[model samples]
Target: MNDGPNDTTDLFFRDATDLAHLIRTGQTTSAQVVQAHLDRIAALDPAINAIVTLNEHALDEARAADAALRRARATGGGPGPEIGPLHGVPFTVKDSIDTAGVLTQRGSPIFAGRTPQTDATAVARMKAAGAILLAKTNLPEFSYSTESDNLLSGRTNNPWNLERTPGGSSGGESAAIAAGMSPIGLGTDLAISVRGPAAQTGIVALKPTHGRVPMTGVWPRVPRRDWHVGPMARTVRDLALAYSILEGPDGSDGFATTPRGVDTGVGPAPQRRLRVGWFTDSGLGPVDPQVARTVQRAAEALRGAGVDVEEVTIPALQENNPLALFNAQHVMELKPAMAEATAGHEDEMFTMSTTMLSIPDTSMADYLAAEQGFERIRDGYAEFFSRFDALLLPVLPTFAHEHGAGELTIDGQVVDATHVQTFTVQFNITGMPALSMRFGTSTDGLPIGVQVAGPWHAESTVLHVASVLESLSPVKDQHPDL
Candidate 1:
């Protein structure tokens, strides 16, 4: 908390959309906006370790944006050049996503000095929308774990409580946004990477349907089918804005096919009488009572808002655990690539990556069986969505946990750290869209979040429901006391 004399210091806490409006209306200069966030990062990031690399030319980019805005103003209301919706706003990216000339070490020493010549599709799209890249955030090695610790960048601590993790592999991105270091950032989700971290840090994140956004330039590119690139922001509207810009095929990633009949923007009118399902546990593991209560409260809020909210159990979802399917697929597909990437530098690899490589091989028959089982899970979700607009569930079994903890206790029952993804992995397996948002605070003062999930290509529905819940959430405006 460096309380600067400049009035623009408070602007760092505003959402991306509002920041862009301030710049557009001449209320604030892009240079000032960028400087505000840069100053905040300088003051707050030391303890959090969220931002791993700062862009040296960020101020220069802000100056360029300011000049462009001045040029547009000189036109006297006549359009000269198209200004992006996010003009002059600053953003960050996960370390694994490529940024031209910026280090993308993927949280591993194996790629310690690696830098890309071209930006990832998502990065280029954000920049083209007038977002200045301020810095790169931290993640687990190759983004293999649910925590954000790594040998290259050490660990990213939760902004709410320094002793806890921010959740990963998008942990750094969420931590940065939570601490007001950046307004919004890009993160990749495979399993619970994006949504999990967002839940832990009290921010907003969207895991768009698989293929809704391009996945080009992401490292350790295994689990290709489940990998997703989405935006993490402080507001759902900002997430929608970024999603609109980042969606669609970029002609690079084969999986980035154009979505048919999908509405990327949030409409002005509120949805009416939507059907939603609420559940405390996905049956994969035990959930903290406080977390479960938060989900129930969200459902009741929606019910009060005129939405048809009901507590229903999808037996198909509860009967089988899909975590093993993901693990099997990941190990089968990524083992060869990991071996190649770290060929002679095995000692530099992190424990997670090395351990994943050591997993016993799965036969082709086993891989096929797992894929078939995954299809059944997808079908189950499709059937469930046909009856409801969205499902509300816990983002994690518990709130943020202590760093390096081998196991977590939920309701006096000890569970392995691997079960942290229990509630989130199903969506990845089903290729459905899911959004994580802050719903309430824990008894220990940590944030609790709930997941809003929808069928394939139904991101708009998911976001709409999240926006509704956000309006009724008591912790909507709450931020870490950092």
Candidate 2:
């Protein structure tokens, strides 16, 4: 509502709910809000490279939104047509999500010049809710890597420490939101894409139960059972708000037909004590002590708030490493499409995709074998959740590392850099809803986050627990100096 440059800068940091309230009350025009964000993006994006493609018609859309607001006001607060809950708020979308007439390159050189003629179901839903799309954030090529870098868009730097990575494949979205380039955005999670980057950049993100949100137009679709598209924001409430608008069955995606729905209106802490299970290690790999301690602090805080929190282990989580399963499934499903898209230009593909193409094809027998193991992981979580309302764990074994490092150290143990997904991939295999939220900071002042996973289709419970942690977190309001 404040139009002065200094006030507008602060406004950019406000969550989507606060911005929407200002616009709905007629204290600020959509045009002003959109312009302020555009200015911020223009000023900061060069350092982070978070927004790869800016929407040229954003200001025009804002003017139209202001006109709509005016018309709604003229009607004396009585709705002629329903005004969207997010009317006049600006948001960004990951490049993997299609936006009509916007370039959706998918961070692959093969898709250069690609523009979608229609919005993806998720994007359409947000637009219908009156949210404006301002740009598309970057990602790794075909979203295959945990770091957001590609030959097409270069690398996206972490807002906290430019020398380090903003974890990807959804790294750009996390960076944009954390740097105040966008208050809310969309990100995809297959393994740790959304949660990992959010953890690294000190933001909030959700990997809703697989299929809770339709994946109609996301690219390089593979591991169909594990892929998810979810919301990222500065606050748990904003994440819930976006989820409410983006969720529900779209009729086209069979995975979206679940009867459960998200409750954006999480009014207060439950009157009854909720049982929660907390663990510092998932048996996937060793966790950094700081990361582990952060989870411990979150558990202690929950216990202080009257939630019955205790340490528990899912031994079955150690039975299988899902990296092979994911690689095999992705190679089986995505190779042909990459071959077709690149055609004779195969030599120009991103290094990761190029390496992926060189890997031998996965036989049906091998893929089926992997599926059988995945079923075990899913069953393990089902059993665990049957006894506890939710499970809490660290999002990664360590904080964000120097980009392209071949190895990392966690608690004096050396680990392959690629193993960063060790703690996160199992959830993707199990199709559970997970949230990553800022909880603590590293000695170097980098942010650390913890993951909260709930039963299938239990996004509301996940958000509720995350809200409690957010309230208790020392780093909840922390941001990068940038």
- What's the TM-score of every candidate structure? 0.96, 0.95
Reference-based TM-score, model 1? 0.96
Each model's C-alpha lDDT? 0.88, 0.87
- Model 2 regions lying over 4 Å from their true place: 1-6, 78-81, 259-271, 363-365
lDDT of 1: 0.88
Candidate 1 ranges with C-alpha deviation above 4 Å: 1-6, 76-81, 259-261, 264-272
Clashes of 2: 0
Scored by TM-score, the top model is 1
| Residue 435, model 1, lDDT | 97
Most accurate candidate by lDDT: 1
lDDT by residue for model 1 (311-402), tens: 98877666667887777766788889888888999889888888888889998888888888788788788788888888999999899999
Residue 301, model 1: Cα distance from true site in angstroms: 0.3
